[model samples]
Target: MARTATHSPARVDGPPAGPIEIDVRTRVFTWITDRVGVIAISRMSAEDLARARSRRLSHNVVTSRVFGPMPEDVSLTDLRIAGPDGPLTLRLYRPHGPLPAGRHPDEGLPVVVNFHGGGGSLGNLDQSDWLCAHVAARVGALVVSVDYRLAPEHPYPAARDDGYAALCWAVRHAEALGGRADRVAVMGDSAGGNLAAVVCLLAREAGPVIDAQVLLYPVVDLTFDAPSTTAFERGPMLTRADMDVFRTNYLGEGGDASDPFCSPLRAPDHRDLPPALVITAMVDPLHDDGVAYAERLRDAGVPTRHSDHARAVHGFICFPGVCRAAGEALAEICEELAARLA
Candidate 1:
C-alpha cells in the first residue's frame, strides 16, 4: 500500500477580518526556510535539486511521522494501471469502520481521489501516505491517492490528463475498490490543488461526475502576480521564485498561462462545478488563489466553504508533528470531506 500527506504567519480567512496577522512561530520557521533557501538550495541547479530531493525523500518516508504505519483500523495497498505514459501508480487507503457486513472495498465505500502538491513535478505516492491514512481513518472513506506525471517534461496537460484518468479509473472501478462511484470527490494541495479543480472542470465533458472538490492552497492562477503573491514574495516555504520555478516547470516556455486547464481561476465559468472547500493560509503567496476561486465559486452559485488557518503558513499539512495548527487543520479538512461526502 502507498501513503500520503503550511506555513503561515497569517490567516487566509478571506473576509470578516482585517489585515494579515502573522504567527510568530510560523514567521520563525519561514524565516529559517528563507535563510536556508538563500544559503543553499536556491543556488543549486535543477538537476542537483532533483538529486537532493530524491535523497531527502529516501529519508522522509522513513523518518516522517506522517509516513509512519497506518492506524490499526486502516489498511493500505499500492497498485498500478495503464496510462497514456507507461504505468501509473495509485496508493489506496481503506478503513475498517462501519461498513455493512456484505460490503468491502471490492464492494464500495465513499472514495476520495487525491492528487498531491509538488508543483506538478516533485510529488510521488509515498509523499502523500500520511494524509491518505489520516483521511481514511478519520473519514472512513476510501482514499485513493494518484501519482500523476510530473512537469518540465510532461508539461501542462500531462498531469491534468493523468488526473482525469485516475478519476475515471476510480469511478469505473469503484465497486471493486469497495468505493461508491457516485460519492467520489477530488482533493489536492498546491499543484495538486490546481489539478483537483481542473479535473472537475474537465469532468464536465468526461463521463464520471465528481462529487466535490477540496483545494488546499492551490495554484489556481499560474500568473503568480496576485497581490498575495507579491506580499508573500519571500515565503515560509513557498517564495515568489519558488512559484516561478513551479510555474515555469509546469508550463515550460510560452504556454498559455490563461488557459483554464492550467489556471482554474482564469476559467471563464465556475458555474456548474461541484461544491468546494477552499483552504488557505494567510502567509502563503498562493493564499489568494484559494480565496479568489472561492469567491467566484460562490458568485457562480456553487456551494462553497472557505477557511483560513490563522497564524499559519503554506504546507502546514505536512508538519502536524511540529505545528499544532497543522494537526488541527488536517483533522478539520478531513472532517469536512467526510461530512460533504456523506
Candidate 2:
C-alpha cells in the first residue's frame, strides 16, 4: 500500500484525513501472500475450492477476538426454524435481567433478524455471535442470526427464501423471543446485505412490516456495472475476479443475474420498502451499488440513509480489530437502529 495506493496503476481509496497505522505484524504474512499470487478459482477443482474457501472463511469469521468480548448482560441461544430448503439454524441474542419498570417479556422489544456475509456460503451463527450479542445488549433489542443455505449448493432464492422466512418467523414469534413484532428489521453484511436488500424488496409486495433495514457493504448489482466495480476491481478484499467466482457459485450455472432477488438494483419498484441504512466502505467495489440503490430508493419515495466509511475497507464491519473505523461504523449501526426502532 502506497498513499492512495496505486496497485499496478489502480488507484485505491485513500485513507481519510487521520492516522494510518499499517499492521507491521502482518507484513511478513503479506509478503508471503504476495509471492503466492492470487487464488485462481478458475483453475481449481470443486473440491479444492471448497477446502480453500472453508479455510479462508474459518480464518476470517468474526469472533470476540476481533470484536472484543460481548457484554455480560447478553445471552445467546442456538435454535432451529423452518427454512425453505429444510430446517434452518439460528442464534438468538437477548439481554438478561431487569427491563424497564413497566416492560414485560410478552410486551417484547425491537428485533433484528441478522444474516452473515461470506458470499452466503462461508458464514455461520458462531462467527457472527459477537455482533448479534452487541446489538442485543447495546440496543436493548432481541437479535436473531440466521444460518442460511450457501452457494454452489442451495443456490439463489434458497438463501433469499431462508432470509425472508427468518424475518417472518422473527416477527411471528417476536413475543416468545422477547422481540416486538411491530418493530423489526432485517440486517446483513456483504452478501448477507444483498439478502437483506432483496428480502426488503420481497417484503414490499405483501409481507410483515419491516421497521428498518441495515445493509453493511451490500452487493446490490449482480451485473457488476457500477463505477466502484471497476474502481475497486482489485479490491484489497473483494476483487473483481473473486466476485466473478462468488457470483457464479452463488447463482449456479445458467442462473439469471438480472433477477431483482439477485440484484436489488435491478428492481423496477423500490417504493414502500422500509427505511434503509446503507453503509459502505469507500474502498469496497460495492460502494457505488449502495449509492445508486440509495438514490433510486429516494426517487421511489423510500427513506434511505447512506454512510460511507472513507477509511474502512470491505468487510470492515466484521474485522473491527483490523480497523478503528470499523468500530465507529458498527457504533453508527447501533445508534441508527436504536433511533429508528424507538
Candidate 3:
C-alpha cells in the first residue's frame, strides 16, 4: 500500500516531549515519522489521519491481545441481564471476594456499565475481562460489562441500541445484580467509549438518567478531523489505518458519521448528560476527541472532570495489569463516580 506524509501546519500543544520510536516493522509508522516528523500527527487534519489509518489496517491485524491475564484476585461471573428488548447477556465482575450472599447486596455496591472498544468492530467481554475485574474491585462497584453487538455484521446503531438496552437493563436490575440502579454509571474505551458517551446523550434525551460517565480515550467526534489523529497516525497498539477500517466497518452503507449517536461531539447539546469523568492519553489519535467532548460537556452545564495521562497512549486503560496508569486511571474513575453516587 502507498503511504502519504505531510508536515503539521499547527503549533505543538501536548504533553512534554518524549522519545519517538518508529515501528519499521510497520513501515507506515516509520514512513509517517520520517517524512512528517512526529509532531505532525497532533497537528494534521482528520482526513489525512483517516487516509493514513486506512494504510495501517491493510498491514496490521487488529486483535484482542493483552499484556498478561487480568488480576486473578477479582472474581467474575457471567449472566444474562434482561433488556427492554429481550435478554442481553452481561459479564458481572465483583471486586470483593466470594459473595457473602450469592449476590451483592442492594444498597452499597455501585454498578459500572462497561462497553469494550475496538472501533466498534472487534472487542468482547473476554477481552475486557481484566479491566472490568479491576474496575469492579478497585471501585467497589459491580462491574457489568456488556457484550454489545459488533460492527460489519451489527453496524452503526445496532451496537449503540444494544448498549442503551444493556444500560437500561442494568439500571432496572441493579438491585438484583447486587448494586443500586440509582447509582449506575456508564463507561467504555475507544469505540465503546464512543458508545458510552452516546449513551449519556441518549439517556438525557429519554430520562433513563445515569449518575456518571467514565470515558477512557473515547472517540467523541466523527466529523471534525482533530490534529491528534494526524500526529499519532501510526504507532504501537492503535493505528490510524486501523481507525479507517473501524470507521468503514462501523458506518457501513447509508450510515451518517455526523450523527451524534455515531459522534457525540456533533451533538448540538451536551447539557443534561450525567456528570462525566473523561480520561485521555497524551499521544493517542483520539486524544483530542476526548478533550473536546469534555469541554463541550462542561460548557453545557454538565459536571465534567478530565484527566490526561501524559505518558500513556490510546487504550492504555485496558492494560491494567501491565500499565500502572491503567489501574490508577480506573481508580480515578471509581473515585469520581463513587463520590457522586455516595
Candidate 4:
C-alpha cells in the first residue's frame, strides 16, 4: 500500500533572520524570466492584463514540462459542477493501480480538494496538474483541483464560496468519486492557500469536517505588512507590487482586509480548525504570512507543522523541475496529509 509521511506536530517558527541564499537553479530561472519582461500585474496596462488573462486559460506546454512530468499512474478528468454563481470546472485525478488487499475500490481512498495558486487572479486547473496528480498517485488519494472563479471579474466570496461549495460537493459525492467522505483534506498554494485556509475556517463553523490543510507559501495576511513583505519586497518570483495587484483584484473597493476570511492570520480564534502543514519559502515576500499563521494555529491548540525552505523563492512548489526544495515540500505535504487522513 502506498503510504505518506506521518502527521507529527513539528514547530518551526519561521526562517532564520538573515539573507536567504536562493538555490542556484531558482536564481537562474528568475533571472531569465525577469529579463524576458515578465510583467507583474501591478505594472500591467489594460492590454497587458487582457493578454495575461487570455493566456491563463491553458498551461504553457514548455512550462508544464519544467514543472516536472505528470505521474503516469494518475488519470485526469474534468467535470463541471454547480458553483455558488454558476457552473465550476474541477479537474479530478485518480491513481490507477491494484487495490490493497481486502479494501474495496470505492471506500479506501482519501480525498484532497486542491486550489491552484495565481494570487486569485491568474491560473487554471491545468497549472495544478503537476501537484495534484502527484499527490493522488503517491498519497493514494483522489485529488480534485478547483477552477474557482477568478478576481477582477468574480471577486471575494465568489472564489471563497466556490471553494466551500466544492468541498461540500466532494463530501456529498465522495463514494461515487472513489473516495472516503470522512477522509477529506484541503490543499493549495499562494492565493489558493488563502482559499484553503479560509475554507477550513468556514468548515469549522459549517460542516464537512476537513481532516488536514496543506498551505504552500500562503498569503495568510493581506494587509501586506509582514516583515518578509518589506524584507523581500522585490522578490525573485513574487514582489510586493505584485501583491498589491492581487489584493486589489481580489478585494475590489471597500473590501475588508482585516476580515479573517481575507486574512486567515487575523482570525480571532484559530482554536478548532483542522491539522495544518504550512510550508514557507525564505526568499519570498509572503514568508512571514505563512509563518505567523502557523504560529497562530499552533498557539490556538491546533496541530500545526511548519517547514521553511531556506533556499527557495516564492511559488517554488510549482516548479519542482528547477526548485530542488519543491520535491521536498511535496513529500512533506503528502506525508502530513497521509498521517492526518489515515
Best candidate per lDDT, number? 4
Clashing pairs in 2: none
- Judged by whole-model lDDT over C-alpha atoms, candidate 1 comes out at 0.75
Model 1: per-residue Cα lDDT over 176-263, one tens digit each: 8777888888889888999999999989766677778888888898887677787777666877877777777788778889999999
Higher-scoring candidate on TM-score, 1 or 3? 1
Best candidate per TM-score, number?
4
- In model 3, pairs of residues that clash are 41-230, 41-231, 42-231, 53-240, 53-241, 54-241, 95-137
TM-score of each: 0.86, 0.84, 0.77, 0.91
Backbone clashes, each candidate: 27, 0, 7, 1
**All models, RMSD in angstroms:** 5.4, 5.7, 9.1, 3.7
Please provide, for model 2 over 1-342, each residue's C-alpha lDDT reduced to its tens digit, 9 standing for 90 to 100.
Answer: 211111111122332445433354223333343345334344457786677556532223354455456678887888988887689988888888565445565567899999998776566665566677788887778899998988778888789999899999899998876678899888899898999999898887868899899988898889987767877676556678878888988898788889989999899888899888878777667877776776777777777776767656677776555556656767778877887888
In order of lDDT, best first, we have 4, 1, 2, 3
Task: Give one digit per residue, the lDDT tens place, for model 3 in 76-187.
Answer: 7888765545677788887755433434444558788999886776666766776677667656778889888766776787888999988887788777767787787888
List candidate 1 segments past 4 Å from native.
1-28, 35-42, 56-70, 97-107
Query: How well does candidate 1 match the true structure, expressed as C-alpha RMSD?
Result: 5.4
